[model samples]
Target chain A: MTQSGYASERETTEGRVFTVTGGDWDTVTGSVDPLSNEKIVVNMGPQHPSTHGVLRLVLELEGETVQEVRPVVGYLHTGIEKNLEYRNWTQGTTFVTRADYLAPLFNEAGYCLAVEKLLGITDDITERANTIRVLFMELNRISSHLVWLATTGMELGAISMMLYGFREREYILDIFEETTGLRMNHAYFRPGGVAQDIPDSAIKKIRDFLVYLPKKLKEYEDMLSGQVIWQERTQGVAILDVTGCLAMGVTGPVLRSAGLAWDLRKTMPYCGYENYEFDVPTATTADVWGRYQVRLAEIRESLKIVEQALDRLRPGPIFISDKKIAWPAQLAVGLDGMGNSLEHVAKIMGQSMESLIHHFKLVTEGFRVPPGQVYVSIEHPRGELGVHAVSDGGTHPYRVHMRDPSFVNLQAIPAMAEGALLADVIAGGASLDPVMGGCDR
Target chain B: MTIEPNESSTGGVPVSADPVGADVNAPAQVPSSPRKGMFGITGTGDVSGFGGLVRRHPEIVGTAKPYGGYFDEVTDALEEAYPGFADAIEKVVVDRGELTLHIKPERVLEVAQIMRDDEALRFELCSSVSGVDYLNSDARRLHVIYHLTSMTYRRRVRLEAAIPAGGSLPSVTSVYPTADWQERETYDMFGVVFTGHPNLTRVLMPDDWEGFPQRKDYPLGGVPVEYKGAEIPPPDQRRVYQ
Candidate 1:
């Protein structure tokens, strides 16, 4: 209510205003303006929701334009490869499956193929098992791509698409959970064959999913394709041509989007992928929009493969006949958890002493693989997933290295993001679909 | 000789104890090295009679000419394309439907350049670059494996180079720019320095981290885990299959 030398008041026609405190603040105003420098550094993640898992991007910004982008990974590193060295050959699937959480089947398939090759038993893998692998891997590809579409759409301001994307993804995950007993990190694949046969319930769920997904995919395309905002955000943003993709070792949909039809399924068939007839989709624009189209098309292609694999699925033993490498326990999830079935347990416990001893020895100390190394690559959702496995004629792995597609494809971020608008960094990264679990494994 | 207790004190590193007396016809024998049982318990732990198992660390012998399938064509093409191939190539190992061309560490760059540029052997894509630690098996224990794919030919070839720990291998980043992060990862994990890489920093591990985590001798350090107040030893401290 009182006016002193520290406070001053001014009256206008409409109102009265007061100014308070020391006005001659030269020290506070002496520093240069932050906007005047024309360059700023922004750290975008490791915690940000849009970064996808724990990827950190350090960007040098020149007023909303990215001058340089340095992607810092390894925050999610769990040393799965190192841990694999301590486990038996069959137990390796558990570790590798967790590497690429989005595409666990791909990781398992690649690792198993490498192990089978090392044991010189590639041809011995049952046709039914291989068919099952193709079936699950194709389903995994669709689920992984759906998450990519959903998250990328959310990150680019289409919130509703994210919900729809996840809804369809949940259907696929339900199929996975019913079959493998876990939704995300299913180590269903084993060295000689799959851990068990696909149950009849899982088949029914998959058939239902096969019908439900195409309609959802059409709905997604109709919703986002003509939206003006989506078009402006994606088209011509973060463009990396075929040459850039090749130089950065970008594969899968990103490389395909850059106009190279180099899908390992087509070029180098594995797990009887050649048996299924599907087209490798490509887009020439080499931008975020192109990646979107390519991934969406890939989902359709995966659905086609899944349908064929379903039809070709014949009734046969899923595990290899070789008793040496085949898992001893007939695994089934009990009320407590996954364990040996009652019949298998009863047989091993009461029937023959030799059978019990054999089962115990095999389960604890697995069959030894002949010493050698092999690299097996499978086309994962993100790119080419390669497993470099070495066995020193032992039950446990000597060394196993996974060349995860997310790890290799993330290297192209700087080439794709630099000199583009800062917001496009998120777009480009989302387009690349870098899963940090796979990248840092 | 008396055995020492609490070997876990050294953070569960292998004791390098003398092997048992099951030394019948083992090629590279020092002693009978039986893997310790669970919780650092030194015993056969092999109830199924695998204790006498002598694992075969088969020395990779290069296959003689006509190296089967497309391998022969790739070799012929490389030999015809690059004049220095004879000197650059150390060994040609064909195993399990895959071809491995072991090259001198110093000549990796030159060999890669030729492998990429040559019309006959155009491995345009270097699919994967990784390092393996063959700790006691080889004198040069650190091996860098490069998996190259020829999209034009639809063929794959493995080029590998073995170098001593801390030895520098010529970086193939010039030949395959994609080898950038892979070389960094190799450097970070196996400590194999890439001589000519543009930015050779740790890509996977933190900058301040010490010791290559993936090396065979490097300990997989972890505190003993306890379940319901009963302590269970860590993996390294537990039984190992040597």
Candidate 2:
């Protein structure tokens, strides 16, 4: 459909004149045969901006309504899971953080927690490290939600919100850069603790974000929350009942919107989430609007948590005391914009021979986790991000399986979009927020 | 009192609990011995001595076995719940701290259902379903793993079922409901059939795809091309790409 303000016309030889509407109505109509029993196959992605990231949906259409939607993933699969088996335990964190690009901290935390549990040192993680983890995770949650808002807005035709959302997200990335030395795929959360301590400059930036984001959130609400077009496009579109959501393993805002407060953070506390004070946002409508409202409310809740975490911040050791489990030194950005801290280099070269040897051995071979397996799950921005890591009492993992929420949640598309208008597919898919990198990893 | 040799073998040592005879399997006592270094412990003498120790304490013997990666507290709980659970379980492994119980392929769904419905063993949330191909293992190479969580107890368990290549196993979709996509994914990747699954169509991969890619035996096919006048080999041909 070209947005040219005119309906293209066509004529049939059966003494009837029919208008061929939009671009290539013949191809569209030819793809479907009204007389035949075969369903029309419509390919929706791989290049579509609304499919999140390189996701392809093959929708079986019956006229304007969807009959079935089969999502085609793995176009972004980088074999991160298979590759983890080849690397040492410590090196594995760098790979996992790249799985869920939007919420890298959560991925790292879940992976590291599982490894720590295997090592039987879950209780040994320093309080400072845990608190920093909570702070960064919440920050990651906010940043991820902002991307969701931005992309969802763009998909729903609220173009300006896209720019506004990215502008706000840039501030969060700036904080990440200052602290972890990388914006995306920071790999900041190590097994026993964080890669580096938070800098005062980063803390000030986060405080600034805490003040700046709430006002911007309200501005977004003012702009689109009550707008007629936004309401029409989102409200009552792609309604997913609680049964459908749970059946499809769709958790997070979408499931929360379906009137089920099934957040892993509240249901199963990890990393001292039980100590935090924040409300789990829910909506009863179970529609696109419900998901939108739930996510917006969640942003507010996350902001509150971040503010509390910032206030609770105290100076202490950021890494675990167990030298075997912890990274050798805090990483800093190199001249080439890669991680290369002075402490790391000094330990590698100028330190005592034994110290240098230990550092080299630990870095190269990594510590062996006791032979066991652990499944560590966290409430990611999209949904439940679980890491099923299995160690064979070796330096490397035996099997590292990531239960990426985006991948599982994307299964709800056909259930939600079937029998709905084709236009609703965009709304439904955007509401699911399936990041392809995470899904295909 | 002197203990019977048969009773000792069965780990049925009797202890006084409140003056009543309680059958508590007392940890087998060992004589004070000289410590052995790491390398020394792997010698023939140490191996035989270790084997003798196992012969004495059979209950704690299997606990130290070198499981590939399937390890977790759930395994211990399952063993406690069903005495001789290791016998019932087809395979018990400790991988990375995640315990995997490879149950009989047929009993997978039933075991999963029981795990969910039993109040004491409530695995309320089916967190993830995945598949792995152990081509170098047994003939039944396809392994389906289900990660279950009990929100109430704050514990997690993994249920694994393996099938021979082209064989089918029971589906747990009815038990957890979340196993729908996971089962499909297993089927898609490993060609493991999940009987009685509601929707067992291919997910991620196209419906008409020919081979299961995740299996170790399956060649990693790729598009070969020339990059800057240099020939690029397929994935299966390359050991490590620069």
TM-score of chain A of each: 0.94, 0.90
**Per-residue lDDT value at A290 in model 1:** 95
lDDT of 1 by residue, A1-441 (tens): 446666677787878778764455545665767677889899988999899989999999989988999999999988899888888998899999999898888989999999999998999999999999999999999999999999999999999999999998999888887777778788899998887778899999999988888998899999999999999999998899988988889998999888999999998998888888999999999999999999999999999999999999999988998998899889986554457888999999999888898898888878988888899998999988999998877778888989999999998999999888988899999999999899999
Q: lDDT per residue, candidate 2, A374-426, as tens digits?
A: 77888999999988776645677767889999989887888888899999999
**Candidate 2 CAPRI category:** incorrect
| TM-score to native of every candidate shown | 0.89, 0.78
- The candidate maximizing lDDT is 1
The candidate that wins on DockQ is 1
Off by over 4 Å in 2: A1-39, B1-102, B116-124, B132-142, B150-155, B164-166, B174-177, B197-202, B205-242
Clashes of each: 3, 22
